[model samples]
Target: MKAYFYLLFLIFSLTSHGSYGQRPTYSEDEIIVKTVTDEMDQVFKSPDFLKKKNKQFQDITGTMVVDIGIIQSGKVATFYKVENTITNIDFINFVSEYILQHKFKFKLPKKMRHKIRYSITF
Candidate 1:
């Protein structure tokens, strides 16, 4: 009886002390923006993209603020809006199309839809 009581106590203590495996929490600025920034940098720094950008958008210089909405699944971007500062229509269209066609690799919990603001500098 004493051994059974001790074993029960041990089990209860261990279970209570165990972590419940909660999902990691992130600040919006830290994870979401950084993920977008990293992906944008990777895409823009590629030689092929660079060549095209230089050929077509060499003189373009401005900052574009993008509002991106992430789906609840967080693996995909639901929609995005570019607050354009540059006057080049073609450049704006290209950037918008690129964003629209791309899927984000970073994923978050499906608890809620997430939105983030990102800026691109040229």
Candidate 2:
């Protein structure tokens, strides 16, 4: 009878301890955003996309801030220039139109199907 009771106690203890072990947690939106942002940074750094428009103007320096809205379909639904050099308005507008026409892919969780804001500066 003592052996049976000891065995029962051991089993109960093991079962309770198992529940206390590490449990898997769901991914958060912040993690998703960080991952997508990193991927986009890599894409921008690639030479395939950043082609030189003017070879003669080697010293041309300007920065443009693009605001993009990622739709649920993983495409750029809307794009606009939020900020940029005053002299580069035409360039910024052209890029914004081009981005809107092109399709983009982003890895996002199903739960976050809503639109997401992204900013690009170059």
Candidate 3:
């Protein structure tokens, strides 16, 4: 009887640990936001890109709003909107192109498309 009880307890403890083990701290949405921010940071910090951007707008300082759509396959399907506080046509075009060229590195469920509105500050 003692051996049988110990075996049962061991099985229960193992199963319980498996079911409630370590979990991710960040939510799915937060993870996606972090991914996007990290990618954008790389783009903003690139030497060649920064040189070009600086040449166009020496003192550019504002926020740019970007609306991105992600398909079920996790690909960036479209760039719906790109708006910035600085109303320079050249600046908008350059930034818009840079954003549109970026490839997001994440996946979503196959049920429906996901849309995210992200802001970039300069």
Cα displacement (Å) at residue 14, model 1: 32
Candidate 1 is scored at a TM of 0.61
Off by over 4 Å in 2: 1-28, 52-59, 101-104, 107-121
Q: How do these models rank on lDDT, best leading?
A: 3, 1, 2
RMSD of each: 7.8, 10.4, 7.8
> How close is every model to the real structure, measured as TM-score?
0.61, 0.51, 0.60
Candidate 1, residues 70-114: lDDT per residue as tens digits?
A: 664444464455576889879988877766666666556557667
Best by lDDT: 3
For residues 61-100, could you state the per-residue lDDT of candidate 3 as single tens digits? 8988888776655567777546778777788778777766
Predicted structure 3, TM vs. truth: 0.60
| Model 2 poorest ten-residue lDDT run | 52-61
Better of 2 and 3 by TM-score: 3
